[model samples]
Target: MKALPITVIRSIELLGLVLLITVLYVGSSIIMPVLLSFFISIMLLPVYRFFRKRKIPEIMSIILPILLLALFLAVLVWFFSSQISVLISEFDQIKKNVGMHLEKLSKWIESSFNYSATEQTKFINEQSNNILNSLGNILGGAMGSFSNFIIFFGLLPIYIFLMLFYKNLFLKFIFTWFRKEDHEKVKEGLKESEEIIKSYLLGLLIQITYMTILLGGLLLILGIKHALLIGVIFAILNLIPYIGALFGNIIGVLLTLSSSQELSSVFTVLIVIAIVQFLDNNILMPRIVGSKVKINAFAAIIGVVIGGSVAGISGMFLALPMIAVFKIIFDRTETLKHWGVLLADERPKDGENMI
Candidate 1:
C-alpha cells in the first residue's frame, strides 16, 4: 500500500489525541478513581512485596497496606478536625479582626480616592452580597457532589486490591500487546516506569514531611496561630507543582490574617513561605526527587491545567506522574519518541539538533 502523506499522518495523530482527551474528560468520574487507585497501588507495591517475601498471606499483604493508608488518613482527618474546632472557637475574635480590617480599608479608600464612607459601605455591601450568593451556589454544588466524593473513596480500596491481586495477569496482558522481539524493550520500559512512579511518589511523601516540619515549625516558633494547619495545607497543596505553591501561599496568608489582627503576620507568612519554597525548589527537591522524570515546565504546566480542567483537583495532582508514565511509553515506542522529546526538559548542546 502507498504510504500516507506526512500531513495526513500528523492529522490522524492529532485527531486520535483529541478523541482520547474527549473520552478522558467525558468518563472522568469512572477513570479518575481507577487512575488514582493505579498510582496508589504502584506506591504500595513495595510494601506488598515485603509482606509477600515474608510468606505473609496474599490477602493479608493487600489488607495491611490499605489499613496503613486508612490509618494515616484517619489521623490526618482527626488532626485537621481538631485544629478546625480550635479555629471555630475563636470565631468571635476572627470576626472582630475582620471587621476592624475592613473598617480601616474603607477609611483608607475614602481618603485616597475621594470616595465617601457611605459610598464605600454601600459598594462593600453590594460586593459582599454577590460573594455570599456565589458561596451559596458553591456550597450547594458541593453538597450535590458529596455522593460522588463518597463513591470515589469507597471504590478506591477495591480497585487497588483488584489491581494488585491481578497484577501478574495484567503484565501478561500487556506483554501480549507487542511483538515477541520487542518484549525486552517493553520489559525495560515497565521497569523504568515502575521505578519512576515509586521514586516520584516516595519523594513527594518526603517533601511533604519536611515542608510541613519546616513551615509549621518556623511559624510555631514565630508565635503564629494555626501554624500546623497552615503547614499541613501548604504541604499538600504544594503537590500540584507550580500552581499549588501559589494557592498554598494565599491560603497561608488568609489563615494568618483571619487568626491574627496584626498585618505583619501576613508578611511573616509570605516571607517564611518564600524562604522555604526557595530551599525546596533549589535544594531539597533536587536532592530528594532527583531527575527521574525530567518534564519541562511548559509541559508540566499545560498538563496540570488540562488535567484540572478534565478532572478537577485530582487531575491536577495526578498530572505529573501521568505525564511521566506517558513519556516513558512514548520514549520506548519508535513512532511516539517525538512526543517524549516534546515533554522532556533536556536542552540541546551547541551544534546538536533534536531532529
Candidate 2:
C-alpha cells in the first residue's frame, strides 16, 4: 500500500468524527422521548413514595399519580388552547395596531438617543412585518404537522408505563453493574442524584409559580391588556431557562407598548421582568435547588441549548436534569472526579450555592 500523507489521514479522522456525531444526533432524536418519559417517572417517585407510605399498593399508588399527571396535562392543554383562541381572534386587532406600537418604540429610542423620529422609525420598521410573516408561516407549518406531533405524544404513555413498571429493575441494573467493593459508592451516588433532581425540580416549579403571579400582577398594574394570558405564557416559557425569560421579556414589553404606546409601561414591564429573573436566579434557585445538583451556569446553559437543539422543547426541559445525573455519576468515580468538578457550581469549597 502507498503511504498516506499525515494531513490526509487527520482529515479522514475528522470526517469520521463528524459522521459519528451525525449518527449520535439521529439516535438522540429517537431516544429523547424515552429519556423524557423516564425523567418524568423519576419526578413522580416522591408522590409514589408518599402514597406507598399511606399503605397504598405500589400499583395503586401509581394509579393516582398517573391520573394526576393526566389531569395536569389536560388542564395545561385547555389553558393554552383557550388563550391561543383568544389571541388568534384578536390577531386582526394586533396587526392593525402594529404601526402604533412601532411608532411608540421609535419615539422612545429616538428620545433616548437624541435622534429623529423618522430615523428611529426606519430602524425599527425595517421588514418587521416581513419577519413576523415569516414566523407566522413557520409556525403555521409546524401546527399543520399534527400527525408528526401525535406520534411523539402517543409514545408518552408507553414510555411512562414501562418506566413505572420497571423502575425497580432499572435501579437494580445500576447496582448490579458495580463491583461488590464499589457498591457503597454506587448507592451513595444514586442517593445524591435523587436528592439533586428532586431539589432542582421543586425549586424550578416554585420559581415558575412565582414568575406567573408576579409578572401577571405587574402587567395588570401596568395596564397591559390580556395580562394574565401573557403572564401565564411567560411563566411556562421561563421554565426553559436563560433564553426563555429573554424571549418572554421581549414579548411582554412589546405587547405592553403596543396597547398603551407608553414608554413608561415598556420600561416598567422590562424592570418587572428583570426583577423576577433576579429573584429566580438569586433567591429562588439557590434556596430551592440548593447545592443538590451542582453545576456552573455556562454548563447549565449549554446543556439546555444542546437539549433544545436535539429534541426541541421536550429536549430543552430534560437537558439539565439529564446533565445533573451524569454529573452525579461522575462525582462518584475516581477517574471522572475532575470532569464532575468542571460540571459543578463554581462556588466556595466550604459551602456552595445553587442559583
Candidate 3:
C-alpha cells in the first residue's frame, strides 16, 4: 500500500489539532477543575511527605496540607475584602474625580479639535449607555453562572484531596496503559512533571510577595494612594502571563487616575510599573520561575492565548505549567521529542534544524 502524501499527512495533523482544541473548549468546565486539582495536589505533595515521615496517618497527611491551603485562602479573602471595602468607601470621591477629569478632557478636546461640548456630551452619553447595557448583560449572565462558579471552587479541595489520597492508584493507572519496557520512561516523565508543578507554584508564591513589596512600596514612597491594593491586584493578575500584565497596567492606570489629582501621576505610575516589569521579566522572574519551567517565551505566549480562549482566566493561569508538563512527556517519548524541542527555549544547534 502507498503511504499517504505529504500534504494529506499535514492536513490530517492540522485537523487533529483542531478537533482536540474543540474538545477542550467544549469540555473545559469539567476538564479545567480536574487539571487544577491535579496541579494543586502535586504542589501539596512535599507537605504530605513531611507528615508521612513523622508517622502521621495518610488521611491526616492529606487533610493537613488541605487545611493549610484553606487557611492561606482565608487570609487572602479577608485581606481582599478589607481592601475592597476601603475602595467602596471612596467610591463617591472617585466618582467626583472622574467627572472632573471628564470635564477637563472634554474641554481639551473641544479646544484642540474644534469639537463642541454638546457633541461631546451626546457621544459620551451614547457610548456610556451602550457600555452600561453591555455590562448589565454580562452581570446578568454572571448571576446565572454564579452557582456553577461556586460549585467549581467548592469542589476543588475535595478533588485535590481525592487526588492526593489516590496518588498511588493513579500511578498504577498510568503504568497500566503502557508495556513494562516503557514504565521507566513514563515514571521519569511523571517525576519531572511533579517537580515542575511544585517549583512553579512555589515560584509564584515568591513572585507575589516580592512584587507586592516592590511595586506597592515604590508607589507608597511616590505618595500614591491605594498602592498596596494596586500592587496586590497586579501581582495576582500577572500569573496569567503576557495578557495579565497588560490588564494589570490598565487597572493600575485607572486606579491612579481616580486617586491622583495631577495627570502627571498617571504617567508616573505607568513608568514605575514598566520598570518593575522589566526587573521581573529580565532579572527576577527568569531566576525564579523561568529557570524551572524551561519554556520559550513564544510557546508561553501562545499557550496563554490558547488557554484563555479555551477556559478563560483559569486556563491562562494554568497554561505555562501545563505546557511544561506536556513538554516533559513529549521529550520522554521517542516519537514526540521534536514537539518537546519546539516548546523549549534552547537555540537549535543549526538554523536549518528548526522545527
Candidate 4:
C-alpha cells in the first residue's frame, strides 16, 4: 500500500486536533476535575514517595498529603474570610463612598452629554431594575452550580488517591500505546513532563507567598485600606498570566477607590503594583519558575483564553502546565516536534534560562 502524502497527513492531524479540543470543551465539567486531580496527584507524589520510603502504609501516605492540602486551604480560606468580614462590616461606608463617586461621575456625564439629572435617574433606575432581574437568574444558576462545585471538591481527593494508588497502571497504559523501541522516548517525555509540572506548581506557590507579602506589606505601609485583601486577590488572579495581572490591577484600583478618600491613593496603588509586578516578572519569577515550561508569551496568552473559554478560571490556572506537558510530549515525538516548536519560546541563550 502507498503511504499517504505529507499534506494529507497534516490535514488529518489538524482535523484530529480540532475534534479533540471540541470534545474537551463539551465535556469540560467531567474532564476539568479529572485533570485537576491528576495535577494535584502529581504535585503530591513527592510527599507520597517520602512516606513510602519510610515504609509507611499506602493509605497513610495518600491521606497525609490530602490532609496537608486541606489544612493549607483551610487556613487560606480563614485568612481571606476574616479580611472579607472586615470589608463587609464596612459595606455602608463603601456604599456611601461609591455613591459619592457615582454622583460626581453623573455630573460629569450630564455636563458633557447635556443630559438632565432626572433623565439620568430614570435611565439608572431602568438599568438597575434590569440588572436586578438578571441577578436573580444568575443567583439561581449559581445555586445549581454550587452543587457541582461541592461534587468536584469532594471527588478531587478521592481521585488523587486513586491516581496515586494506581500510578503503575497509568504508566503501563502509557507504555502500551507506543512501540517497544519508542518506550525509552516515552519514558523520557514522562520524566520531563513530571519535572516541569512539579517545578511550575512549586514556583507558583512561592510566587504567591512573596507577592502577598510584598504587595500587601507595601500597600499597608502606603496606608492603603484592605491592603492584605488586595494583595491576596491580586496574587491569586496573577496566576492567569497576562490577562490576570491586568484584572488584578483593576481590582486593586477599585478596592483602593472604595476605601480611600484621596484620589492619589489610586495612583499610589497602581504604581506600587506596577513596581511589584516588574520586580516579580524581571527578577523573582525568572529565578523561581525559570524556563522549565519553555512557553512563549503568545502561546501562554492563547492558552489562558482557550482554557478560560473551555473551563472558566480552573482552565486558566491549568492551561500553562497542560500546554507544557503537551509540548514535552510533542517535542519528544518526531512527528509532532514542529507543534512543540510552535508552543515554545525562542531558543534560550547558552546556559541561560528564558522564562
Best by lDDT: 1
The predicted structure with the larger TM-score, 3 or 4, is 4
Off by over 4 Å in 3: 1-12, 132-136, 349-351
- Model 1 gets an lDDT of 0.94
Q: After superposition, how far is residue 274 of candidate 4 from its true place, in Å?
A: 0.5
Report RMSD (Å) for each prediction in the order shown: 1.4, 6.3, 2.0, 3.4
TM-score of the candidate numbered 2?
A: 0.79
Better of 1 and 4 by lDDT: 1
Residue 6 in candidate 1, Cα distance off native in Å: 1.1
lDDT tens per residue, model 4, 83-155:
8899899999999888887888889989999998899999989999999989989999999899989998999
Query: TM-score for model 4?
Result: 0.95
Q: Model 2, residue 90: displacement in angstroms?
A: 3.6
Each prediction's TM-score versus the true structure: 0.97, 0.79, 0.94, 0.95
Candidate 3 vs candidate 4: the lDDT winner is: 4
Q: Which rank order by TM-score, best down to worst? A: 1, 4, 3, 2
The global C-alpha lDDT for each of the candidates, from Candidate 1 onward, is 0.94, 0.77, 0.90, 0.92
Prediction 4 global C-alpha lDDT: 0.92
Ten-residue region with minimum lDDT total, candidate 1: 346-355
Off by over 4 Å in 1: 131-136, 349-351
Best by TM-score: 1
